[model samples]
Target: MDPEVIGAIIGVLATLGGVILAFYLANRLTLNDSMDSKSGWRKELMNIASKDEITLADIYRIRASVRYYPYPYSETNQLSFRWMSSLIINLCDEYFVETYRDKHVASYKCSNSSNFQPNVTISPENDEIVRIICRYLLKYHWEARQKMQIFRRGRDLMNIDDDEPSEDVARIIQLILEQVDKINSSSPQNIFQISAADQLKDILNTAFKKLTITTRRYLSK
Candidate 1:
């Protein structure tokens, strides 16, 4: 081989090696940053769990008329009910996204909403916004059930104890729909005012506990 040709080949190889090294280092740094951001949330969550506290204060409790309130989310629930529901739903949604901080799934979760909006570009596995919402709510239900005999799904009546979150969520959702149909003999009327507005605060408290539990589980993984 000519001396000049050999030198040229060595230069090309050196350049290629540098490019590859640069790429690997950049990717490594990004991954580490992602992990650190995740760890920050997890550590904060652990502290919250250790203290067993929720940051959100109870909703305003003064008795007021809700008879003329605008329709809240296609439902007729009172203003306080909607606000409380949306708050917990949004919190659960946040933790669900946190679960995938290391992956591309983080952007799928949007804050400041009652419902989970599935991202169009996300894959099916990562786009389980609805399932994630239910799982979070179910966790709350399980915790609340310990204190109260209510919130029982039909599965409980059948003595079919199950630990699978997906299956339980599905069955509970189905049963809720079915029960809604059976109980309503006529078209549903708009509830101008919710009598149990005060109880929404209780629900919020239980729901936050579930968020702490589920968030910790995801961080551990």
Candidate 2:
């Protein structure tokens, strides 16, 4: 080959190699960032779960901390909401296991009133938390429905009944559904409005009571 042709070939080969190396590094960095994010989220979840007492307030704080950026609507926010909802549900299960199952509360003395409560006052901030919880539960139920549909389509290959949610989860979901129903029926405009603070307070109060009662009944039996 001519000397100029040879140099041109070398230049093209070097450029291609640099582009490939850049692409590989970019992918590797993205993977690393994703793993780090997941690890941090897991640590935060476990930190709450490891607590001696996980209150409704703790759950609220966790939900608030999980940012749903750009406010109101985004695919990233939706996924974050779903993951946060799952974490909250798992934490509730852990709380039940720690407070009742592990303690053998059927044979131990336990107050039905002392299970879980919102430590915060009935203010707009608290109302926002309740609204978030309501939305999370709604999203969870919707996701569960999607899962059920998928299971139904594959029922011949898998036992769909095996995917049923736990009794505790079912009960809590029922509570959320009932509250959501009331909110839907009575004050549609008051979904998350601070102006509808009283209505939100009532919903939260009822939910808290139901949860406490359910926990009590489960522990009693």
Candidate 3:
């Protein structure tokens, strides 16, 4: 082999090795940065979870109005009922479990109302939502039963300031109980742990409709 030709071949080989090394380093850097970003995201998720707690204070306030107003006659009562319905919908949006946090985090936009608008792209597994819903249902039933007993016994409710409102609340309570019972019974708790908030809402809405119809019929009687 000619000496110059051999030297030129060696130079080319060195350049190729240098390029391979550079690419390897760049790939490693990119991978490390991605991992770092993912780690940061995980931390942010934990922070959010720690900060958010679901409360039913708003529902209680609405319930108070139902206790004092008769039927749908009062504008305030009607408004409160609508607000209560919206509160449940809003609560469902706000209390999504861990899996939904990632996508929700990306698309969340704050508004003047400070309302939580869950991202459409976010879908969480059902158990978390279902558990919360079940808990709510249990409370609703217990409260409703207590109120119904009071109404049936013709006992004056101690804290009730208005008789008509007490009757309305009692009616609403009976309706809610009937609906919750129907739903709770139809969808056995073991029917595949709740996988999404929508599923829970479906169970609630279906049962609630039936309950409302039954209650209205009784009211007419």
Candidate 4:
């Protein structure tokens, strides 16, 4: 072969090898680094509870923000988990405060000659709030307790019941499945590979119904 032709062939081969090496390095670096794996409910739970007081309007705004940005892009994606955990914390806070805030009591005090005036004394301190706050604090601890319970049960059943995996998992799974279906129409059909996952999703949908039924039954009982 001519010298010029030989040099040109060598140059093309070197360029192809560089491209292949670059592709391999990219794949190696990207291994096991999925957006889902970095999501931790505890981190988000901390963020939610970091605030002392949260209002219903705050919850609504957080929820709306989450609904707006449905994808995870490192900094931007954490909004979903933070929003959900904050919502839970807010809801539990409201429930505790409403149920345990105070109870009205009526009393009468006698003054001289057949005259009595009603007197009321509000509790000096909200012990119930303190107790309920302790309970909320316990919920923060309960997240770890639940995980320990599962760990004790064994790692073999990591996703045994599916049950949304965690708040973060539930959020990302929806995004993943929606994208999957968008890319391939048949993807939806394959979503049922895990029966527990399906059941878990159904449970989430009817959670309110279950709450209502249980409340009614308890009232009857």
Candidate 5:
């Protein structure tokens, strides 16, 4: 063989090998970064959900953090998202149930209003908290739909429990939706306006008590 031809063939093989190695390394790095990002997201979600007393603000923050997490591509990531959403929904449902059972049930009268009302005074701050709670409920409903779709498609690999939203959950969502409409109608410009504060507070407090009972009953079933 000619020396020049031999050298040319050696150079071409070396170049091809380098390209293949580079592509492999790049793919490995991408997979690692994706796994890391997903791990961080799971950690944050668990930390929030595991709190002794998770609040609406905490849930809102968790939901916001979820947006920053990478989009769900793998079955693992999809299952994680579905389970996280379920955890959040259950936490909020339990909180409302406990609140109603402990604080508002005694004062509630069937004739006056079918819903329970928390003992807390109606104020602008409380009203704002209620608004946030409504937003959280809506977000939970949306997540529930997403999770159901995942289950329907059998996309998640984990053996997760049933992700169906209970009748009580649906009822509470409807109550909140109604309350939101009332709040919005009363003050189109600003839901948190002082003028509608009293009405808004009453509506929210009633729904909270009703949701609490509804959740408790569902759990007993």
Candidate 6:
């Protein structure tokens, strides 16, 4: 080959190598950033779950803010309210699912639900999730549903067998149903699984009583 041709080939090879190197570095950086972000999220969630007490007000403060963004990134703020709901339940569900998976609760349809049941089985860890669910996810779900355009598929899966939500008991019933709705609605991508029924028999005790009820006849018994 001519000397000029050989020189041109060498130049092309150098440029190609540079491009490949740049591409690899860009992808590696992205993967590292992604892993870091996930790690941060898990740490925050565990912190919340680990707390002895937290209120909706505390959660509002924790919501990723606007004025403070890491180099102008707000993608984390756009996370669906549903995913936030899932995080609490999903994190707690992992340990229990292996040891105490409730077949009926997993399969329970929400449309016909009378009252929402939570497994108050009380794990040494992650038990606070019950309070989080009752306090935030239940109310937030009702509020969030107003945003989406939902096509009516059927009458309803969940129902209250008691008097139509006259006093505050009705509100309690509705909250329970919303939770079951989210749980039953879980899929491979978005998890919201939590046990229901007589498993967590004491669930109606402390955190729940303080959540949304004013006074209720049904809950008294």
* Alpha-carbon runs more than 4 Å astray in model 2: 1-39, 50-52, 68-221
- Superposed on all Cα atoms, the candidates' RMSDs to the truth, in angstroms, are 21.7, 17.2, 25.8, 20.4, 16.8, 20.9
Go through the candidates in order and give each one's C-alpha lDDT.
0.36, 0.44, 0.40, 0.36, 0.44, 0.40
Using lDDT as the yardstick, the better of models 1 and 3 is: 3
Summarize candidate 2's per-residue lDDT along 1-221 as a digit string, tens digits: 89999999999999999999778656655664586477664455445544544445555455544433322222222223333344344333333233224334443344466563323233233333344454544444335334432224534211123322244444444444455455455533553433333443453343333334544444344
Model 4: per-residue Cα lDDT over 32-119, one tens digit each: 2332237543344344334455433333333332234322222222223332334334333343233223321122223443455332
On lDDT, the candidate that comes out on top is 5
Q: Name the TM-score of candidate 5.
A: 0.24
Where model 4 places Cα greater than 4 Å from the true spot, the runs are: 1-37, 53-156, 159-215, 218-221
Q: List TM-scores for all candidates, in order.
A: 0.21, 0.25, 0.20, 0.20, 0.24, 0.23
- Write down the lDDT that model 1 would get: 0.36
**Highest-scoring model, TM-score:** 2
Give the worst 10-residue stretch by lDDT in candidate 6: 65-74
**Model 3 stretches with alpha carbons more than 4 Å out:** 41-221
Backbone atom clashes (below 3 Å) for every candidate: 0, 0, 8, 0, 0, 8
The ten-residue window of minimal lDDT in model 1 covers 57-66
Tens digits of per-residue lDDT for model 3 on 103-218? 54554554344566653332222223333333443344335334422233454332122222223433444454444444455444543233433444553444344334434554
Who is ahead in TM-score, 1 or 6?
6
Clashes of 5: 0
TM-score: the better of candidates 2 and 4: 2
In model 2, the Cα lDDT at residue 157 comes to 19
